[model samples]
Target: MTAAPTHASLDPSGFESRHFGIDDIFYSRTDGRGIILAANAVFQRVSVYDWSDLIGAPHNVIRHPDMPRGVFHLMWSILGDGKPFCGYIKNKAEDGSHYWVLAVACPLEDGFLSVRIKPGTEMFRQAQQIYTDLRHRERNENLPPEASSDALLQAFESAGYSDYASFMTKALTEETKHRDIALQRPADWRLRSILSIKEGVKEIEDHAGDVVRIFKQTNQIPYNMRLQAGRLEGTDGPISVISNNHRQMTQSLADAVATFSEKSLLGNDYLIQAEFLHGVSRVQHDLLQSFGLEPVIDGQDKAQEKALLSRQQMEFVSMAHKAVVEVSDRVSAFSKICNDVRRLKAGLEMTRVMCKIERSRIAERVDGLDEIVQQLGKAQTDLDHLLSKMDGAVQQILEAAERLTQSRQRAA
Candidate 1:
């Protein structure tokens, strides 16, 4: 085993970001003492190091200076208990270029096997910020790695994560969902048609949240309109008729908005299921690749075992694709509802504008009519804003769906 580098011996200068392709997966095995024992071709390529340089070096040889020492301390503590650790890691290459990976390390027969892939999720970005803060504390406060680890845990807790494991699991799951769709290749096109679907789900989730907010605001619109209608209850002619019609329109709009909220919630639930399935598929893919099964089997039992595993993987892939299809269907429905809401909002705005014009004609006769008109106008403005946001989100979903269809056609 190689000796671990002392903190003072590690350099932290002259490095730039080095990006690897999304499909690249790096694998390495480390001794119990944290010395690199072996690495795959992808690992060598990304690290810009020869096999000779890596094989006997301490695993931390690739550790980037920007990474918090606290993270490593926590990893070692977990590994000591024979538990696997998963995290977003920033690593340095031999040529002083850095890259980020979502890495999982598990105890193997004699040591540990680690597999890593590019991270492409919002949580990864959050993790990066957290790491930067922890690194800053370690340097500025002259804190030891162990002390920084405590701070790191506190930060995670403050961010609403129950523990490090919870945070890592959620982050990894989300990243996997995004990468599954975005990183599909012609040779290994598992979930190939789902490109950008994860992003679309995120968009829909955001839109749903906006819908909930708009519903709350629109819910009040009818109540206010009813109050105004009561003020004009004793009036005669088209004015009274218009007031009644306005109240009716507002109530109908409110009901439509409520229905939209319900549909968005349902769509969001389906998306969560899709994300879970994608995460499982990613784990299966990584496990299959890490095993590095031989193409030419020499024994009957080994061939049988391989075939069984392949069949299982195929089943998993099919299930994951089905989940993606379900998500696409839900998002399509959700997008259609959003479009209807946009048109409904436009109609509401047109009616409100006509009401204002009529109120202007009787400005001297109606004391509070202007105030009512102003309130309705404000409500219309809020609805328009919400609908605009939803439209953008729906467009994103449609574009992703189109891309998925195109990919399938190409594959066929």
Candidate 2:
């Protein structure tokens, strides 16, 4: 582990950080350049800015100085590509007080919509340190936003993420899980099953790679036997016949095995995308419930903010439902792939038997012919075991996906 970054200048003391309910989720909309378009009552209340002060103002009206410019720079770069941005951000109230949120900014029609939740994860604490480190660099070294963003990504990698996208996926899941714990909500069965399947797929894929490598090693065995046959009694020898037979059987098995890869078995992705998107939909559903619990606004003006919120919530829900269905379909595809792998595993068993028969005839220890058979036997056994485990995992994953697909409509 690396040493913790200093936060000497990023301390929250005398900062008058405002506290919001654990259930509170701030919602807002912004134009391409980040001018505020619409916001929910919670956003208005927490920022201490009235509708008049917030609407049409730059969305940065509440941006806290402590927030690194590089974060916004990174955000715009991602949003420019029409992708969503999820990260922890600090914001300021009109009275100069501050608050933090795990903001998920998603693309909307002609603009963007952001839903924010109060963050309570170890990742959030790490984010604060990174922000402080970047801010310090900007102050002392005059680091540009883009350069700082590159450095930020390296920091994310150091923190165990592969890249920004991976970091955000992990960060979003952690934030959602922590929030659920705080709210005393049990982890959803579908999510748990999906996560388990993801882990199982990784293990299965690794073992599958070993199978391919081991199978490649068998390619030399037949050639070696033919060489020995030539030395002992020319092409007419029993060793030569056994070598030809082994080649035919091994080729057939290799063809069956080569028709697939870890990618094929998992259907393009290992359910990581589905896990995150399903998580997104589930968390958004909870947010909608929270949105409904706020006091109804008075007057036509506040009423309009509430009206916008209602429409945004519905629109977000519709989008979430659509996304979940697509990901679930891909998840179900893995089940079919698993069935195909099971049939292939049977082929592997047949190949192993044929090789064993050939090895039985070669009584002479010709270049350790038995060793080749021994290695093949072990590799086949390992692959078969992994495939058997995959069958069970895929079944569980399919059941979980079905549960979500069936309930998505009612939940939406």
Candidate 3:
């Protein structure tokens, strides 16, 4: 086995000579024994100590109090065996401010190579929970605080993370996709408004899948959309669109449902379809409301609109049927007038014949009656023709009603 490199023997002020010109990151190489063999200028800056002060010191000099030592112990186990290891780590800075990093560290024959990046918020939160638990165990067991790192590793293992590498992979992967970034309005709406709403729902479902995938990767607390209330504070986020648009769709569907007429069987079937649509709206509205958005349909407006629409539809149908009845009555009235004129004509004709044996004055009266009868005949014919056209109109209305009923039944 290769022996660990000796610590860099140098004066504090001469750090620039021993470790110089590394990249912007804090760079360091530590031997098998944890001795710092080399450090770049950035490392000196981060450690809050000059090169001379840091060179011979253990690499643990910058370790923050909140970091579990067991993580390092496990990290070393893999690296000491010439393997790569990665983890989320907390590192203290010269200014006492701490930063979280997702660290990838490797072991070489001579020393170790480490690289890191900023950790995600969710990762930091989970790490905090784990480290806190480790701290409690350390206190209860009276073990050295650093020894709690073992407890953390055990906890992670118990939770089924195969190793530090796997855990880090999951954490990094979880942070990769932002749910809202993947959302897009669906295409192929086919000019159907309802289909468009359905497409939006599909997009939301896809986003929800992303959320679930992230949770599987991290084992962290998954997002609860119902609980995310402040998502609209900025430019509208995905959740904001969902909440607002969903409410709008709900109100629209409710209004459409209310427009169905109650008297027509076909209209009633349309109402049933509307009810199904309304159910979808209700569920969506409830979800959005849970996230603190105002619903598009208020309680009173929904109730009043539904009742008013039903009443209006019934009134409209009743008025149409009443019109049919009024036309029939007009026909009957015209017939009665014709019948009275006919009777008068018959009486006048008889009187005129009898006048042949009497005066010509009675014959003149019969002539006047004949003219009245002629006008009544013309008027009766016109009225009858108008009544016949009205009957045809009534037939058309009934046919329309039948067709509408069939269509609604199919839709239902």
Candidate 4:
């Protein structure tokens, strides 16, 4: 590995770069280990490097010194696994000029494809400051790239990013939003839907946490009934049998609820994966719409480039569509779960009805018997209320995923 560049070595005093318009997008395709394979005209223009110097060259030929080694370490770690990565990157030109871009890197069959836009958002400034601080720390503490990468993630957590996945998606979404405003363009609905899906999935995950508590509360009804049964009559009486049956049914229902919670969590992961690919497709689609249509020396090269770019974008889009469908199926599973829970709720209602009947039949008075029946009534009421809300949320998610799926199909 190249020795980590020190802050002094990467000082901005030497930065001399050309500014590209916010509309300008830089594109490059590189091999697995960062060897450059192809590039767009804008990238060639900004880097001040010809096709001869860029093609087959290590991508680091343009890597800005001011960029902390930690960023690249984190970047390659994700990209190495054929995953997509989005972050702000500063690149150096052949004559040492520098320009910053919000870059999205996606893994390709042969290597990786990067699409970058000039960042107009305030987040770009934040990224610059973060990189400077990390580079300074690396120089002062003799930190390795991996250690500096850990520090960078800690810095992100301090800045309100829960993890790298959330941070990357939010950052890309922010940059895209700012770009639209800067260009005086309408909002990109594609990217907006991706964020909305992510938020919806998070809501589902939060609600899943309550399943255990809700199911556990119902267990108390049987226990309370059994206690009262012992006082009202000898053990193994009619009330005792009813309580035992309630326990068995509720136990099975509890197991089903547990599975629902697990599926909710798994669905949340699918949302993240879908959002990541959607973001990938968004940037590549931009390039396809603008870059491929522009003039190139030979129209054939442009066609070929657009074809490959479209293929990659569609590949992600296809996977994202599948994920959205999977999320929909998970929602359907939740519907079934809610139905199962409803059956248990019905059972509780019946048990309460039986208790009331028994109270009327008894000539001798029993203390707290009415209250236990009321408690059973309350549990059923709560379960009904919870199921209604959960079903509503599930419906909303299903509708949102359907819309998102339709958009993906159109984009494909």
Candidate 5:
């Protein structure tokens, strides 16, 4: 392995901070000994180095003087155990400019894959203070790097993390959440909006699948009710009529639920269209950012025209939101239908009880009265099960709709 660079040998002053874009991710692979093996375009771009200069160099070639040595010691200790390590890192560019990243290093079969992204979180700020204090301890007190590592653990404990592992995990998670929120802002708007809409579409598809399942289960209810009615037709007088009425009511309920499920499927299609339109909007916004020139008299008019066109495109999104509201209404309606089915099942139970009371009178006349009663009981249980599932699915759909509405509000 190549020797680590000394503090005096590396330049530390005169350069401004270089920044990686929110959309940029730097990736590199290092050997087991921490020598760089391969680097991606973003990695090379941010480091201000060519592939030839970076390849085979120690990964710490970009380590900044401001970073505490204890942090690297902890990272290496974790990596030695073949575990992934995540932390906030200050890395020096080839020209001595520095940038901050939330770095995740995962141990691989033959080497390690380290991915880094721009960090703009509160946790990152806390990390900066901790690193600065550790560096101070090392420089002022002449503390060893291992002693600085102990100070790092104390800092994490003081911050409520039980250990380095938990601290790093929370840091990475918070950084990612902050990065996603940043992407939704005007300056950083890009493919992240498209990705978020796609996730919303997936939620719709999942709810639609649940609706299809309940519909299939619901079909059995009407069929069972009709069979029960057929068995009691001639012997039980008005009881047979009550059973037939229930059969028709259940059949109508089944048909209504089927229609509602179709609407949910249609809603899924609308969500997919929304995802596509979000992608288009991201592209248009990125183009505007990339090539927007200074406004002259006629140029300002063109810009206004473009703004008008963008507003018109938002009508598509408005239509998509309307579709979402319709699906939510359908779910509410289906929930009410489930309640009606439950009421009908209760009536069937009462009919079953009456049949039991007149058992001696109709025993010889009705061939399958016992079997029909048993079937009715089983159908009631099945209906209850399906109603429960429908209620849960509707709750999920409502929650998802609220979240989408809030996201749109934020976007506006």
Candidate 6:
């Protein structure tokens, strides 16, 4: 039988220098206008560039040819804005060998401060392969350079999605599962679960606010257009062009609802979710215009409780934010509980399997206490679903916020 791999086995530290692992630091250099000044031994070993050869070359020289141009383009964009940036990068060595690095690069007094850790996890490795393939395809098509992060997302939708939100939802779900998902019991699982659900809903609401901010900041496609054209030719058109793609609207309301369900299961407070939500809603609003489906906020009710509802919603948002901060404080506590529960269940399952393996078919009735464990799993699933529903409802509130913003803008 194959043995379970140890953490050390899964992660190699051979790249460490005499003092630290190779992954401890990939490179430590100062560059002048993207040209390298000095590099560490580990950097030379992994990048396959000799100290002499790397000292004068552009940083892009080590950028893997297969890596997506969009990422580098984004990095440059950040630098132009005088902002530090970080991302997962795949760099090629002098010998054509590839390595993955979780890299952070930022401008310094003279040049830049760059730090990287070698990452060989399956998630990053697979992403590297995917990026490489995408790059190759771009080369063959002779299309502009490559898609912008947003445009790449649009490409996913253009292949078939009503908006970027649906695409991002699907992508995030896939990414989460690829990374590995685990659940646990709560000391106050029920209460914490409820709080978590509220937080998830609030996160959706917050994302809406962010989307509005982004739209306000960059409504003109001209700037992004120039970036897209310079890199990904032919994709510099208005948002209308991509939003109107027939394939983009293939995703239905039902699909969006399901995405909310899956995403709400783990946690919330996504950094990019507002962007995704804004993108999706934009598509939906555009489609409604095209198809002549009257867009409605569904707020026609004139009950006296309207004021109360508004106040309650605001209170909920505030309370949810507080809960989110608390959850962050005790982050991973719930997951640890889940890990304990999972381990216990696995132990029980092993006993049952061993019995079958040995042909000892006597089922030991541990029902007296075993029932509780089973109940916990069911509770976990139910909590997950509840969190999901809350997320959807909260997302609706975000939609309302968006509408409110648009209305105010029009009035102004």
Provide the TM-score for each candidate, comma-separated: 0.51, 0.83, 0.35, 0.85, 0.44, 0.36
**How many backbone collisions does model 5 have?**
0
lDDT for each residue of candidate 3 in 309-361, tens digit (9 for 90 to 100): 33433433343333333333333343343333333333334332432322233
Report the Cα RMSD per candidate: 9.1, 3.6, 34.9, 4.6, 15.2, 27.4
Worst 10 residues of 3 by lDDT: 260-269
Candidate 2 lDDT score at position 239: 66
Q: For this target, which candidate reaches the highest TM-score against the unseen true structure?
A: 4
Give me the runs in candidate 6 sitting further than 4 Å from their true place: 1-23, 146-151, 155-412
List the candidate 3 regions with Cα displacement exceeding 4 Å. Answer: 1-24, 144-150, 157-163, 174-412
Error of 2 at 259 (Å): 2.9
Better of 3 and 4 by lDDT: 4
lDDT string, candidate 6, 118-208, tens digits: 4444434444444555565556665454454544445445556565334334443333233222212123222233333445556544543
lDDT of 1 by residue, 239-292 (tens): 566656656665667766777777775354444444444454466466557446
Per-residue lDDT over 182-246 for candidate 4, one digit per residue giving the tens place of the 0 to 100 score: 87989877556656666666666676576557667767877888888888887887788878888
lDDT value, residue 123 of candidate 3: 56
- Over 4 Å off in model 5, which ranges? 1-16, 185-412
Global CA lDDT computed for model 3: 0.43
What 10-residue stretch in candidate 4 is worst by lDDT? 1-10
Task: Write down the lDDT of every candidate, Cα atoms only.
Answer: 0.66, 0.70, 0.43, 0.78, 0.62, 0.42
TM-score, model 4 to reference: 0.85
lDDT of 2 at 368: 52
How many collisions per candidate?
0, 0, 2, 1, 0, 11
